[model samples]
Target: KALQFQEAKEKRQKTLAALDTMMKGKDEEAIKKLLEQKQQEEAELQERLGEASQKKQAELMSLREQKEEVMRRIHVVEAILIILCVAFSCSKRRLECNSDKNFDRASSLFTSTN
Candidate 1:
């Protein structure tokens, strides 16, 4: 009976030691998996940031093009206004010259009849 008790105690100790080793291995595996997941998440965040930067650049370029187009239209409208003003001034000068000629001719006729 004494020998059987000693053998049972030794078996229990060996089983406990084996269980402790297995628990340690499981803890190590869980830690490695967490590290891998963190790395993957960081990579995804970086990719999203790059895409956002590209979108912002494109928007800036588009706005610049629109501003240039507006400037061109303003220049064209200004040119048209300048041409119209010049034409108006020339027409006014021609009308004044014609009126002066009529007045002179009438005065000559009146003087000859008298």
Candidate 2:
């Protein structure tokens, strides 16, 4: 009877060890699956962020181009206005010089006649 009890105890110990090994394997598998899922989610999130950044960059570029075009048009208008002002000033000075020459000629003629 003593020998039989000893054998039974050994068999029970072996079964318990096998159950422990199976549980450990399942835990490792669960951990691996969780890590894979997390990595996939991270990749998807990064892809979305990249797409959004690209769209924002394109919008910024378009706005910058529009601003440059507007500035160019403004400069053209300013140049035209400056040209007109210069022309007006030159014409006014020419008229004044002509009037002075006419007055001097008239005075000389009158003095000579007297």
Candidate 3:
């Protein structure tokens, strides 16, 4: 009976050791899988960042073009206003010249008739 008890105890120790080794192997596999998933997530995040940056750059370029167009329009309007001012000044000078000539001709005719 003593010998049987010793053999059973040895068998139980061996079984426990095997179970512990299997659990350790499973833990290592789980850790490796988790690391791989984290790396994949990082890669995807980088790709998304690149896409967003490109989109923003395009939007900035479009805004710059619109700004340039608005500036050109402002310059055109300024040129038109300057032309209108010059035309108005010239017309006023011509009218004053015509009035002076008429007054001089009327005085000469009155002196000649007297």
**Candidate that scores best on lDDT:** 2
lDDT per residue for candidate 3 within 49-106, as digits (tens), equals 9999999999999999999877766655555554454456557675555554544554
- The better candidate by TM-score, 1 or 3, is 3
| lDDT of model number 1 | 0.73
TM-score rank, highest first? 2, 3, 1
Give per-residue CA lDDT, model 1, range 4-94, as digits (tens): 9999999999999999999999999999999999999999999999999999999999999999877766655554454454456557675
Residue 75, candidate 1: C-alpha displacement in angstroms? 2.1
User: What is the TM-score of each predicted model, taking all chains together?
Assistant: 0.64, 0.66, 0.65
Local distance difference test, each candidate: 0.73, 0.75, 0.74
Question: RMSD, each candidate, Å?
Answer: 16.3, 15.4, 15.9
Give candidate 3's whole-model lDDT.
0.74
Model 2 TM-score, all chains together: 0.66
- How many pairs of residues in model 1 come into backbone collision? 0
The residue ranges of model 2 lying beyond 4 angstroms of the native Cα positions read 86-114
